[model samples]
Target: MGSEQLFGSIPPNWEYKTLGKACAEGGGDIQTGPFGSQLHASDYVPVGIPSIMPQNIGDNRIIEDGIARVSLEDAQRLSRYRVRVGDIVYSRRGDVEKRALVRNHEDGWLCGTGCLRVRVGEKNVDSRYASYYLGHPNVREWIVRHAHGATMPNLNTSILAACPFLVPPLPEQRAIAHILGTLDDKIELNRKQNETLEAMARALFKAWFVDFEPVRAVGAQFIAPDIAPDSMDTRNPGAINRAPTHWPPHILDLFPDRLVDSELGEIPEGWEVVALGELVEAVKGRSYKSEELVESETALVTLKSFARGGGYRSDGLKPFAGTYKAEQVVHPGEVVIACTDVTQAAEVIGRPAIVRSSTRYRRLVASLDTLIVRPKDFRITKAFLYFLGGTEAFVSHTYAHTTGTTVLHLGRDAVPSFTFAKPPAQLVQKFDALAAPVLERIQATEQESETLAQLRDTLLPKLISGELRIKDAEAFLKGRGL
Candidate 1:
């Protein structure tokens, strides 16, 4: 009969309004994604435009790193439910509280089945503010109450439209949104930067090791006929005249003149195929009792610490009060493999999360269920080793060695037995030189994002409820050098 008692009391200037009233007419504003019957599981493809489903809707963000997607044609067929930048989307059924704002990169992504989209069109309400408001504890309670179905709860368009929102003036609303959005924007930026850095490192790895791009460069030069009798440009591997602006002459110099065949495959003349265990070692985590856990500081990292099955989640850790061994303790830029698999369909058993360090917490110990993966020496950088943990060979090896029925467990003891092609020493050093800094930058960005997220979460409820004045928030931001 009445709106949920969110924020206790609304400011004198603010008023309550239904979500439907906050949207503009025509389309784009409020709608459910394509119905279940419209898009089948078979419609998903290995690569295409990201099809946003419930799994993609993370806490305050949409994570599609490992999400299922559909072909562009299918996305177009369901264009009416397409989500654009600035739109707010929610999980339509189970976990109805899950919500995420559509960012620029997510523009034109099809709003897949089991989701709801809300594009706030009201003059006074900020879209970001509305998105956050929808996730506010009070609004979540309202949605939970209205949500039907006992076995599997569900939400629909009618229910979402009827949801109430507490409104504020445009200026104040924008201020609240700006303060929070600043943090969200930085967090988003860090995520994108990490993705770029990882992509660059992966591409480089594949080029140098798998496809042997450098070898191709040298091979092309050797196989080509001499244009001008004898002397040729020695600096360029891919070209005879001169090297491309992007290709550094120093990297070209590292490529070997000849190639040789090995049991693993074709390798550079002097390179060898080595077991992965020889390059890096996995250190098992220490056990802790529930009674030993404290309510503060960094705790043991579980598989849940892996966001969307790959990304490291700094906030996902719980506090622990027990002591741990040096090997079990993880530091910044370290990778920990999940030894325990808890997914319903045995999804990510041996998945690894790059342990993130922050000023907000002390040491983070790996759980008994995780294995701290460390490079044997400077021969291989931690970044390179972390990337290796994601390679197909590593994943397949882990999946094959896994045991148990209901709860799958990767054989932590046999990590070293897994083998992979070893690159030349100079190439490995070159990779570390180029890739380590990118990884370091990623760790730094992740640390900043985590800190900003904590600040944003702390300020949210109070600021939106008008307990914290806008002027004070601006002063707070200024003090933080925002």
Candidate 2:
């Protein structure tokens, strides 16, 4: 298809010009990030001003996870490379088509090496509109085709500047941005809310199971001098504590007042150390060849499905063409654990994630890199096991069982051999009563965000190219109460 037909019809009065002209007219500048020599690896600090590297650039948003940082002095030295609000940042080499718009929170972050910063000052163009336009499939394809290097596509300032840019009137530009930005804003709000909900669930799990806070509260009421409620710091394996909440008389009665010794450590009075295998069965997933991975409705939850820390990443799914047993098909809310990790730091091996429902796929199966860990014993819930897998102690145990030099692989005994103090069936039920709703809410919110993202992605290209007019798009959103 020709460029014009591929990109869609440019509406009347829309300015078709080079991106360089748009930047020049807007009093903006396109510049490269700091080079390696200018900012050395040794300059990075544990915590300071964030430096936006290529990896940090996501789908028009900067991913904060695993992002690098630099000291104030270093940031000051690289002030010119500091990104401003509404600026667009792109990866200079790999994934050259991806870009992230700098939001207010990311303002003043250094545009680190292997990145290009596009600053469109207030004048003839809207940076948000430009960002959405660049995300067009046609534009992305053009960038990939024009990028230098056969093995590793690379992008420079000139290459980006020479790209086509379609500029509507300033008011129209703002309107298009508002239409798309509203959907994105809601998705972002859902994401932040999910984080809060997850934190709440994790806190509850730690208090009940790991810290034994409820039992400690009971002991405190009885004035057991040996059991100090404040001594939670020493007893907790993670050594991190959320502020203890005042337990109701009924809730306090659920836990035993005294503590007793166990094989793992000093657990609550009635709790006993139990092997994970006794509570859950680890079912290995289907192993398939690369040729079997084709564009289809069937998706496999590969290692990428597990977030680096411990969470589900929908983008990690691979369309599968192979078949497997009916039992291998994992449904939403099921627990899956990564059995392999290619990261040099072993960040993902043994991590657990709950499967999420997909809008685009009909079925999801676990890949060989992951194992479906289902609760065999009714006393424990999937929510409990998921949090248990995320605990520092459990992760440490699994890490010890891992064997590999470059690519870590979880041992067959990694999940089954691991052990933890099992709470009473009553306590497990009580915990589930409190945690299940929160988890459900999280899943619902995530599903809503996924739908919103799909809607946004669908509307983006059409709106950018003027195939779908602004008023019609507004009407569609209004009809849905968006």
Candidate 3:
């Protein structure tokens, strides 16, 4: 397999072939299986046979999560349409670029109308190899160019059958699949680990803040007089004092005083109510001229870049033509609020980030969509403030005040006017100090996830194409012990 002797310089041993030639006798079959509307919402059971759809197909992978399910009776009726293990499913309707390699034998079930399953005949070519080839940049470009319909792009059976492929021998195909699979495996592992870490952090946040368990314990201890000081130990718990309410001999007395009001609701005594604008600097992102944008390695912060999860995406980011001023910069730690869309209102919106680094495109600067809060005279810690802003109450207020039909706009004037009960500075600082490490870990994990995604994106095009051979990739990984 001399690399120089290959077709298009793709390795001599590898032969250039069309997908139609490698498939079963009849041309690649493209047919819609069953309609989704036939399955009623009431009939949707939690755990059952999964109904594969275009949405299930990701970047050379199948997403089982959020998959629709159907009854066994429906599955029997569509038995002939069932996909087998090793079948490569291509999306025919929406998001035509998505494809998946059915690695697990269990996924051999009926797929939705939007997807067509490709079953290779008894040939030396590897299914995984075919999946990667079809998902490659060159093949994808051809598909995109040839796809018909302006409203929705599609790849019919004819187009797919005629699509060319760079066919490597069975051994080589297996080797290539193995090499690429290793990298993907590592990526998936990291993603899962991060998910677990995130879940742990969320659970801790819930226990400490949302449930107010710690505060409740503190409050309980403060009000209970019948419980001995040793029995009220913070570390190991003792029997709780069971004094009658009218008897007035419980820990409630020691708890901090609180006030209930119609306007601001219930709050700790001595806490002040103030508008969000009073506490932080609220600013909108800049709008750059169309021509000013360029593709570069720079990280551009945009509203679309922010995901529902508290992180920024680099995908589809464009560079700024001119140098951005410091004012236009979004420092690592500043809180960013999404002010434009009220529908997505304040979910991940109004969230703050402790900026760890600098970014570009200052002109298309951070938007007023985000209300940046820098601590002022108040005792509220930045971390605590972020958590508060993320609360349902704050989001509801933002949603209520949002104006405009097409694009829901939460104006600057409206933001600053929204108020919340502010706890004493000392208490706020204490909570912030306790919560800082947790928040920092969340930020770090997010950054790590971004880096991993970037690495995968960088390797995808080269690996998918014959430009980088599997042997070379394996050598690279072995050398790095990755």
Top lDDT hit = 2
Candidate 2 ranges beyond 4 A from true positions: 1-6, 222-245
* Root-mean-square deviation (CA) per prediction: 5.9, 5.0, 7.7
Q: What TM-score does each of the candidates earn?
A: 0.81, 0.91, 0.71
Residue pairs clashing, model 2 = none
What digit string (tens of lDDT, one per residue) describes model 1 on residues 1-482?
23545667668998777777667531336888888799998999999989888878887788776777899899888888888777888887778887999888899998888888888864656778888788777788888888998877798877877888777888888888888888787888777767755665666676666666666667665332222111122222223233232334566678775678888677777777888778787888878788877766758886667765565877667788888787788887788887777545455667667887756677788887778888888777776777777777777788788888778888855567777777777778777776677677778878888788788878888887888878899899889988
Question: What TM-score would candidate 1 get against the native?
Answer: 0.81
Give the 10-residue window scoring lowest on summed lDDT in candidate 3. 229-238
Q: lDDT value for candidate 1?
A: 0.75
What would the C-alpha RMSD of candidate 1 be, to one decimal place?
A: 5.9
List model 2 lDDT by residue over 1-482, tens digit each. Answer: 12233455578888677777788888898999999999999999999999999868878999898889999999999999999998999999979999999999999999999999988778999999999999998889988998999999999998888888888899999999999999999999888877766776787688778988778778876332222223223222232235334666677788998788878778998788889999998888999999999999999999889876789888889999899988889999999999998655477788899999988899999999989999987788988888899899989999899988878889999999998999888878877776677678888988999899889999999898888999999999999999
Global local distance difference test of model 2: 0.85
Between candidates 1 and 2, name the one with more favorable TM-score: 2
Comparing 2 with 3 on TM-score, the higher-scoring candidate is: 2
Tell me the whole-model lDDT of each prediction, alpha carbons only: 0.75, 0.85, 0.59
lDDT of 2 at 163: 85
